[model samples]
Target: MTMTAYLQTMERGDLDSWGTPEDIGSETVEGAPECAGSFDLGSPDDPVFGGLYSVTKGKYRVTYGFHEHATLLDGEVALTNEATGETVVYGPGDSWIIAKGTPVLWDIRSDVARKSYLAVTTDIPA
Candidate 1:
């Protein structure tokens, strides 16, 4: 297969592999949530990668290690900024950018939530 650039549609069924329960580090705070992802563009260690992520019903905490721009593709999620204690609810079609090192609490509101994201491991230029 030739590796080339093409437009990829984000769908809920895009994820083909799933993480073990509570595999998202030691930050799991609530119900056991399993996450799955499939990279359509690049690998996780690449400077830039794009993929679809799906999480089962649960809540967890995460500290961003990379900058990510993502849009909710399915279900709902309440994201709280640990530093400011501010919460924002995101539904399908909503998009946001999270900076590296930002601590966030993720609460899945529906049975599951899916998002399509493009992440940058290096600094994003202004």
Candidate 2:
């Protein structure tokens, strides 16, 4: 298959809702948080995918099932790597990478937080 290379501008704003926190394997630990995303590159059958994700103010816990590199587009957040017990505060323009199986505790410190991400997975649904 011929895949065209493209550039996408990720804006920090409303996006299509993927679902509640549970839909994306996250458990809400505090205040209600709305989650949304836009998968702009690759399919679920592909090994790589890229997209924008956003969540409202709250605290949540989630485990990464795939490797991902992400950049914060807007807002502020404190991410705690549960396994390492290390925490990092991120704001607009911050970036990081998360390996598969890494558990994270997300503390949304702003009204909302938005990020653009590229993820890789070995398993593809049939």
Candidate 3:
């Protein structure tokens, strides 16, 4: 089946719940190759703050995070290291790729939404 068909099937199925403050939306960028649907965590600060995401269409990446969140399961994240200036790609079922003191860039090849488990830095003990 094509990617679109796979996405359609995913929409029909019930994915495992990630966290709270569930909010969902989709966006289609102008001059972009594909459309994207996302479920967002309700945290106002930082990326992946207490939420889960799934990419229904294309590829995506995260650029910055003021804080870090722990991962409960395997997930995909594309990151560029600020210290080495290198880019790395994580595959499905990978967990907690991003943590504190990490700066990176995200490149999304397609429209993608990821289920994320995020915890703010303040909440995490030093």
Candidate 4:
């Protein structure tokens, strides 16, 4: 789907249909003193081919490296895009349509918490 279409779908909450349980990776950045997690969306063969994430506790600043589906179900956060130098704040019920190939930095101003649905890309075996 096109980017605009994806954004519109997310805004309308249609993207929720694409969510399912996923395995998330977490780590605490030194000095940041926060815990974070990333869910891995299986493959296209899966029923829900996307990642769902949640910050059960703590606060942190995140750097966005790749384009993926993200939603702010609760709490608050600030995101800065290095390419455009644009910063945006997200709170409950807010969502972000991150463009592909863009780099972003996130500052979890508040006790950072969120849930996201991300599309997974697959690799073909040689």
User: Considering every candidate listed, which one attains the maximal TM-score?
Assistant: 2
Estimate the TM-score of every prediction.
Answer: 0.84, 0.85, 0.43, 0.53
Q: Please give, for residues 35-63, the per-residue lDDT of candidate 3 as tens digits.
A: 22233454644433454444433332333
Give the candidate order by descending TM-score: 2, 1, 4, 3
lDDT per residue for candidate 4 within 36-68, as digits (tens), equals 344355544553345444443333333433445
Better of 3 and 4 by lDDT: 4
- Model 3 residue 112 lDDT score: 45
Clashes found in each candidate (C-alpha, N, C closer than 3 A):
0, 0, 16, 1
RMSD of each: 3.3, 4.3, 9.7, 8.7
lDDT of 1 by residue, 17-45 (tens): 57744564537788878888878778878
Please say which candidate is ahead in lDDT: 1 or 2: 2
- Comparing 1 and 3 on TM-score, the stronger one: 1
Clashes of 2: 0
- Kindly report which residue stretches of model 4 are placed more than 4 angstroms away from their true locations once superposed: 1-49, 55-66, 120-126
Q: What is the C-alpha local distance difference test score of each model?
A: 0.81, 0.84, 0.42, 0.49
Candidate 2 has a TM-score of: 0.85
Give candidate 1's TM-score. 0.84
Worst 10 residues of 2 by lDDT: 2-11
Instruction: Output the TM-score of candidate 4.
Output: 0.53
Error of 1 at 80 (Å): 0.6
Error of 4 at 50 (Å): 2.6
